[model samples]
Target: MAFPFTPSRPLWLLGCGNMAGAMLSRWLESGLDPAAVTIVDPMRTDAPEGVRLCAVPPADEPAPAALLIGIKPQIFIETAGTIDALTGPETVVISIMAGIDGATLGDRFARAGGIVRLMPNLPAALGQGASILHICRDGANAHDVADALARPLGLALWVDREALIDAGTAVSGSGPAFVYRFIDAIAKGAEKLGFAPDQAAALALATVGGAAALAAASDVSPATLADRVASPGGTTRAGLNILDADQSIDSLVARTLQAASDRAVELAEMARN
Candidate 1:
């Protein structure tokens, strides 16, 4: 079932950038009452049809039941204090800002029920995003609330080890950009091999899309699927051999994720310090 759209609990979304905007749109499309949300974003001019959008918290507005911080980690200092209205002990504070830990959040909003750190990818809009969740040790209720909110997106998984959330961010939060780059590389490679630019791009994109669909639909593992594609002495085998012999693709991808994860950890430390 889709997540319940009960408007009993109000939601406050602190920023509406691309990732956060996708989540907000998904929630609204999932039958959540747009009226339940109030988006606070200085630069963003619009919000879902029935939701309120403002540059700052209303002077005398009632505190929301759950507050989700969607800004970048670097800007937390500028925004954290302004969220005091919902810092009551019973209010769940969910943070989507990458690299900020729950302890730091709890310190900023000490009265909150608990702090939850959520890392989600862009694909969440289609309910197919991967979400990794975690919270401070004192945040059980906060975790449940966060999971409830994230469930509208696909594949919400809890990670007790907050460090792993950084890994998740690298693999999921920044992962889409990496995937797109790989698609672009594929298209360029195809073009270099004589296909027209547009034709090469179309085939490269369709190949990725079709391959992903097959992987998702089949029970067989991707490794086995590769075997299925590469029949003995086939052209696919020749290409596979080159990739495997040099370990080029896997090594490059590993390095990419490692770099992203390290940066996330660095950001986490910066926030902690």
Candidate 2:
């Protein structure tokens, strides 16, 4: 319930790939001290100035205040050995690794003072991202510490029931891919109807982007917006009718989310066991 965090403490990031790199870019852009970060990735040779980056641990760097694990979920077992210096009672572990629950992560990094599982999407590269955080009710963690980790990146919220986080992941974490697929389908439809492939692709992409922006800014639901676009039994409504017929589109998306959520649940089981 109570949140506590010291703003002055340093934050270190491990595994700076696309997602984690995006988060660090946001932090640096937001004017957080780049000096506070140390990135250890065997592949990345350079980071922005004022930040220390290396392929392996430096011989004598002091322990970090917060250690964020951004490695792929499947490879967390490799982190099992980097315990003594990286995780301890003073260090808070912020895990961005998907599928691994807080309990399992805590077990992997037992020296951590507190463990929090944060699920974030790729849009974190910009300031627009959806992040879902899960912290156990009986935990020793502090909410403000989680905020300190979350607030800098983007739109952050907590899920009361951890089980729902997989739903959140299915919708937000993996939603971009789904949207892209939709866009491609639309473009392909246009091409089949005789439009040039390049123009069709561009039009579909712009249309989807603009529509999402409009929906986000509008007070009405998407269904209401669709009604506003469709004149009395007009073209948009014709498409809508087709999609509504047999509720096929809705059912397909429902199955899509179910499959993704089930995969997350299965991954949690694998990690726990």
Cα RMSD of all models vs. native, in order, equals 1.8, 3.1
Could you tell me every candidate's TM-score relative to the true structure?
0.94, 0.90
lDDT (0-100) at residue 59 of candidate 2?
60
lDDT (Cα atoms) of all candidates against the true structure = 0.83, 0.77
Best by lDDT: 1
Would you give me the overall lDDT of model 2? 0.77
Candidate 1 lDDT over 134-194, as tens digits, reads: 8763553676678888999888999988888889999998998998998999999999999
**What does candidate 2's lDDT look like per residue over 1-117, in tens digits?**
221322345677778998889888877787767767888888897898888887876566555667778877767765566743565576677777767776677667756677777
User: Where does candidate 2 stray beyond 4 Å?
Assistant: 1-8, 137-141
Candidate 1, clashing residue pairs?
none
Report, for all candidates in order, the number of backbone clashes. Answer: 0, 1
